[model samples]
Target: MGEDADVATSLADSVSEEIADRLAPVDAELARRYPGEPPTRQPVHTVYVPADAVSSGTVSAWGEQAREMLDEHAPDAVSFASVLGLPSHLAGPVHDRVRAKLEREPVEDLRIDFEDGYGRRPDSEEDAAAARAARLVADAFEDGSAPPCMGIRMKCMEADVRDRGIRTLDIFLTGLVDAGGLPGGLVLTLPKVSHPEQVAAMARLCGEFETARGLPEGRIGFEIQIETTQSILGPDGRATVALMIDAAGGRATSLHYGTFDYSAACGVSAEYQAMDHPVADHAKAVMQAAAAGTGVRLSDGSTNIVPSGRREQVHDAWRHHHALVRRSLARAYYQGWDMHPGHLPTRYAAVYAFYREGMERAAARLAAYTGNAGGDAAVMDEPATARALSNYLLRGLDCGALSSGEVARHSGLTRADLDALAGRATEAQVNSGP
Candidate 1:
């Protein structure tokens, strides 16, 4: 038995060596792709929170919750108010309700609903309703009583509706500027962006609008709604969240996850698992990739499963959904939508957890770099280490964890490293040894 065991061990070792020899080139190639101690990790400090859609006269339903959450959590992005309670076919009531809400809390950003505020048909009535909604929100901004940030959710820029959507956005933005109600910034929330060209077209129109209005070029940005499976893993399999921003040429401020729509698109089974399933993963992957180096923020789609029944169930549901969000954040997401107020703590927790992870991961990466080379020796490029370094710098900027100088100091690499890596540094640079 002892002789047989020894022979087996000898054969296994020989096979392992042979396999390593065959794989060595691949490992080297991968290593070449990732070099050096990864860029230092930085904690994500600021987080944005956008209020999901709701009905008229119901901003208060979520406003109080927002106020409390903001006070306790102090989220960096806050779109805490919206206009609600209007019927699908009426523009007047919808506009008026929004006006009331703005009067109450000085809404940061106002959303214009198509199916809800305007009728399905692009008739005079629907057009009027959309115009009215745009006018009011613009008025609030021009009057100096509006929130510093402002945006609108417009219909998809599909070939069929492209003309209409562009017309509506143009009218709204033109109204805001002409009425002296233009807010700090304008975001065109485009639903179902299937191609980069779609975003580019919107950008071009925005430029045209800027020229017409005498507004500076690049004054507008896009917030793409990643609600379709195609946007995540279709023929354009690499559709990432960052690509959404890049399509706008540094103008995209955020990427919003469209949960319900995305679920429907992906045909998610076990409907309740939308937030945690493969569909959500692809959606988030897109968003996270878009957000990686761009200053643009990415928001997870809304958790449609609302709070329910017994006190504990409500709390548990919220926590469960929020936990999913926290997971997203830990994986480097910075924003997500909250359909209900109870999800507040979960959002806050996600932010805190991300920061904590950033701090720890960054400190450890830095420590590893220093320890590997006796504290003063420069680090070499190793794939894992390189990725860490690159990610550290990029994520650091996103998280506000490290300044350029500090990053240089810790990594012994300059802003040039940051810039070069950010520009086209390959994944091969991600794993260089220290």
Candidate 2:
């Protein structure tokens, strides 16, 4: 008994010491990152850009369009769809042009697709080329012209497709590191992730590879697409989704709605069940339920509408799409897909609208938190209020609706706290909008 007690005491002491050591660096880093009690709002915002947007012939055109789009929509951050946009062409010049185009704009973050777009299969040469592209892009960024944040999206985890998926990831990532193209983060776009076992395997693979290569072990993160019937409806679907993320060992940062695939999985024959479709609601619920309290961002699927040449119609489409995107933005999803260049405005409008609405709500909650008569301390716990407010705020930040100074005025909380709370509230989107 004495021996056991001594062992337990030793374990506890070691844990405490380890925690203190880890926290020491964290505290210092936070201090350097924000010298003072930062404002309760974040100046940084993230927006999604598609891979197809900046392909070979389209790089300059897309870049020019992006500048215009940013001028109009004013996104805080933007991610390009990829260096792999050139496909099997594999020349260094293709990558250089992409890099040049990317360098022309300043963005908060960038996401590069290591695998071929939307498809899980990749040939060996293709995979090898992707790794090279990643390396080149990283080096370009290091030359001080690229975005500070970077992420890579690899293949998904479908059982039948697991072998190809693993190979694609292994080759691409190994090449990435070997070529000195290690990104700030790794994003695995897990498609049809029906069970926790797949997530566990992915975690283990990342851990093993990172360790072997002397990189940050398990530093690789994931973003899953809840786009299948099996994923959405397990023997118990919602629970499975939650467990899969847990099995991922806290590495998942986002859960996206894959509209087309999900609709197909649900046996919905209709070809055009847009974001407003009832089927999409079910998909959204699955993603939201899984994301709650997980500290992961939730994103709605893309708007598939192809923009026609009419400016009035395009503007009208923007308004209509913006309202719907705002609805999702209000629901605490900070990001949504832009299927077309014209859809850019809709994305920004949604983000901006969300931020403006969130600021007002957050101010009210802070007031209530200070003066509420309810004895339940939980009454002061306005998660729903915070979620609504923060979602809007983040949307605004992303879309340039709220300026850094304005964000500072609305929330007295520090930036880190504000970011953490806002991200958390969005993840725990329990509020039905009070």
Specify the poorest-scoring 10-residue window by lDDT in model 2: 78-87
Q: Write one digit per residue (lDDT tens) for candidate 2, span 1-434.
A: 66556442436678988999989999876543323211222212233443333233232344466456534433322311121121232223222322333335334334455333534334755465555545544565566544444445555665566676677677767866776647543345665576778888888888888888887654677777677666666784255677776777866666777777778777777666677778888768767766665456677776666545564555456566666676775565656655554554345434443445446455445435534332223335566556555445544554345565665555554444555555433322323323
Global lDDT of each candidate: 0.54, 0.55
- Report the number of backbone clashes for model 2: 10
What lDDT tens digits, residue by residue, belong to model 1 across residues 1-434? Answer: 66556542336667989999999999986554333322323222111222223233333455565445433332222221111111233333223332333236423344555522343563565466556656656655555544334456666867877777776677767767777745654456778787777878877887888888888666676677777666666475565444545567656656777777778776665455466677677668766654654545666666667655664565456566656766776565655665555554444434433443354345345435545332333434454455555555565444333456655555555555554543444345543423
Q: Name every residue pair that clashes in candidate 2.
A: 38-414, 40-413, 51-81, 234-237, 351-395, 351-396, 354-392, 355-392, 355-393, 358-389
lDDT of 1: 0.54
TM-scores for all candidates: the values are: 0.58, 0.67
> Candidate 2: deviation at residue 383, Å?
6.6
Q: Which candidate is the best by lDDT?
A: 2
Regions of candidate 2 where Cα sits further than 4 Å from its true position: 1-63, 66-124, 144-149, 179-181, 236-238, 357-361, 364-400, 410-434
